[model samples]
Target: MPDRLAPLTEALLAAARKAGAEAADAMAIDGRSVSVDVRGGALEQADRSEGTEIGLRVLIGRRQACVSASDISARTMAEMAERAVAMAREAPEDATIGLAEPADLARAWDLALLDLADPAPEPGAAELQDDARRAEAAALAVSGISQCQAASASYSRQRVFIAATNGFAGGYSRTSRSTSAVAIAGEGLAMERDWAAESRTYQSDLPSAEEIGRLAGERAAERLGARKPKTGAYPVVFDERIASGLVGHLLAAINGSAIVRGSSWLRDAMGAQVLPRGLSIYENPHRPRISSSRPFDAEGLPTAPRDIVRDGTLKSWTLDLGTARKLGLKSTGSAARGASSPPAPSISNIALTQGDHSRAQLIEAMGTGLVVTSMIGAAINPTTGDYSRGASGFWVENGRISHPVNECTLAGNLRDMLMRITPANDARGHLSHVVPSLLVEGLTLAGA
Candidate 1:
């Protein structure tokens, strides 16, 4: 715990109690971020910012109020508490809004095992600019590449402390570093764009800027002279990079808040077979080097691994304390929040089980279909599971990639599409959301 943040949180909690609140929790987050962008072989934009933010959440019987401020002075803390309590008195009552009980609070945990932050000194602006320049240069080196769109590098560090009137208190620090490059091919109406980026808790884990840039340039060049495929029902294979979106839908549907409100497509899907047999989606928050790993959540709850989808069946809903209480369930230790808002249920470090076939083998298995490499917009029905998206990718014919295709709409029902998924073995290992390329059979494709 940072010296300044912990004391600030304790003071806010004290102020809230003195202001006649029955219960309260306080949070303080101090963070610093730096970013540099390069374009056309010149420095384009640079930014560096740092600040401390504090929030107080007070409960007056069933009513709750949350107040936040960037100022951490003593006077601001008193005013925040006073205002929070006053607002709570006027707000509508909610039976489920309260802090976790003392028995359920995480008392002690080893954050070192999570390995969230890098101990290295912060990278200077010059170093970040150099990285951006290198990425841009590498992207422009690729054959058939028209030009590099933008290249950038960024770093951030944050320290968080949470304390409550109840006996819960904990803090941790995390750091992130990233590099990205976007490249374009062709010109005017025929142009296409693609990008590559990587982020890691430790800078050492990030792939080389040159490698990231080269991959972006190649992806863009591959889509040059894209033509639309014929309109028909065909299998669609989502590339590994974007395949996680499919799983993300399931995650959203199973969120405790959505389920409690009866607004999720998967509300009645518990214990139902949601995925192909032999596949499971696991949530392991303790994985090292990944950005989502955390020993304790924002609400001071110990996080542990669980099988969200077990043996292809929908097993659990992601839940925080409040949502879990509303759903008549226990917290899954997935609470996440910022200084400006209340806690919410969220997932961390997800890994879908991989299959034996490689991406190429899956493409071959697809036979005649679409390999959707990128998607633009989404139109999804949360209650009905209807999903449609504008997509662009390569067309497959006779078990081989024929040419790039664009101006297509891939439409399918989420529940039906995921039921027949064929996974490939090409999931990026270092990503927080680890899902393989998925081939869904019998989807409607509208093109041209």
Candidate 2:
């Protein structure tokens, strides 16, 4: 544990014991991040920040309460712990609230999640500016490219620690870098802008500046003149980037805390078929080269790979210790927490199984369809599986993207969408929710 976190953790535990609490936990996080935005091929904004926070939780005979602060001194911790215990004492007691049992804690796996060493010096401001400029410049250099909207680069690092009275203690750190560009092509009212982004755990993993720029340039150039498609139901294909939203929706629906509160649509659907027969989903905390991979959860519980959905059947609900006890189920080591909040259930790396059809093949099979590239607006009701979102993309005709389309809405029930899932073989590992292009029939598209 970091020297700054250890004493605070001990003080919190002692305070909880003195307050007649059964168990307690504390977590601390310190992080730094920088972002730079370029517009019109010039630097538009640059920002850098760093901060640390501490949180304390106490369980007083089944009633739990939490408090957090950015301060790390002994006096501050003692005050926070005192406040937490006082709040717990006055709160309504819940029989299902408690920490993981000693036996359960003993079963945790040992995994390394953090890289303790300092991150390498990121690309300097000049280098980052050059990278962004180079990307946009390349885009503009492409034939038919006319203008640019924005280009940017960002880097960030985080370190976190969790400690509990029941002998759970852990911490880890990681870094991230990203570069992106957006460019417009053509002129007059027919102009179109397209964008591309590349993110990586290490800077070295990022695609070359030329590659990212060329992709953006080509995408914009290809959409020089576009038109609306005939309004009607059609098979829809979601590119991998946009398709990841479905995975995010699944995570929200299977959250253990939501299940316990009757807020999740999947509350009673475990073990039932939730998707196509060949589809499966798993949460793998140990997967390499993924941003969300971790050795242990936010509550210091050892994490392991587990099937969230198997062969289209819902296998389990993600759980934290509190919710697990309430539901009479075991925790899946999915607990996550911010520095100032209690542990909540969340997925680490959600990996969807790929199928045997390439993106092009899937498009070819569709014959006439809409290929969604981006989504707008938040229009999902996780509690009921209802979803509708504004989308922009290209229209495919006879196995080819015929025109760019905008001002369209895609509406459907999530449950029904999952059941209609037909994946293509164009899976890419660019996002945390790695997924292949998805094809679904009969989606309602509201547009001309």
Q: Name the best candidate (by lDDT).
A: 1
Candidate 2: global Cα-lDDT? 0.80
Q: What is the lDDT of residue 204 in candidate 2?
A: 76
Backbone collision tally, model 2: 1
lDDT tens readout by residue for model 2, 334-446:
88877667788888887788988888888888999899987889788878988899888899989898888887888888888889988877766756677888998888888
- Per-residue CA lDDT of model 1 for 304-332, tens digit only, reads 99999998999999999999888888999
Every model's TM-score: 0.99, 0.92
- Candidate 1 residue pairs in clash (backbone atoms < 3 Å): none
**Alpha-carbon lDDT, every model:** 0.92, 0.80
